[model samples]
Target: MKNDITTRRDIEQLVNTFYDKVQRDAIIGPIFIHVAKVNWDHHLPIMYSFWAGILLEERTYVGNPMMIHEALNKKSPLLQYHFDSWVRLFYETVDELFAGRNAEYAKEQGSQIAQLMHHKMRESEQ
Candidate 1:
């Protein structure tokens, strides 16, 4: 089915599937397992809101994502790798879950965000 602007459920399912893979992946899995302490049931909805805001411009998510990532950065040296993996998983998840422009839009935004974060992290390391 084609994903519309109001594809929060689709996004949530995609995120959950991505996280399931992330939790099992070799390079990036342990990082999330260690840092994200809460149950997926509790975390998924928050992430759903965050992605919903990003994709649909819904004002549902209020947390500062940069701050959260910054905190996580302090705990890991492979920030770029983690971000890359996240973006890759996100794109794959979207491709698997939905058809049409919404998936493309999600990947475009995700790529931009990942690039920006990678630049910032590299700058901070210098």
Candidate 2:
């Protein structure tokens, strides 16, 4: 079992694998490619920093995540679905790569973030 503080390398691998799947997923692939235009080559490191901050209590992320997601919501209009898929992929990635307390923490934090994002997206609609 590996530590699950979601290190830079861990985050990188997770995002890479998840996006690889996302690129092929029918429901979510087009949304990400068309709306976010996520250049995996460029975006992965930023995401790594963001996740590192979340799991490690570091300050690697300094930008406004909500604002970014809000923009994405406006484009996708399936924010909840995206959020759910994101969590699902994240859990699967962590489970595949690590275990023990770190993995548990990742699950807990990922679930909470997903729920929070779902709520925020719903709120934005109202």
Q: Pick the candidate with the highest TM-score.
A: 1
**Which digits, one per residue and each the tens of the lDDT, describe model 2 over residues 19-53?**
78778877788887887888877777787777777
Q: Give TM per candidate.
A: 0.85, 0.84
Q: Between which residue pairs do clashes occur in model 1?
A: none
Residues 1-126, model 1: lDDT tens digits: 655545667777777888898888888888778765647787788888888888778888878766666667777765667778888887878777777776788889888987887777677778
Which ten residues in a row are the worst by lDDT in model 2? 1-10
Off by over 4 Å in 1: 1-5, 36-38
**TM-score, model 2 to reference:** 0.84
- For candidate 1, the 10 contiguous residues with the lowest summed lDDT are 1-10
lDDT of 2 at 107: 83
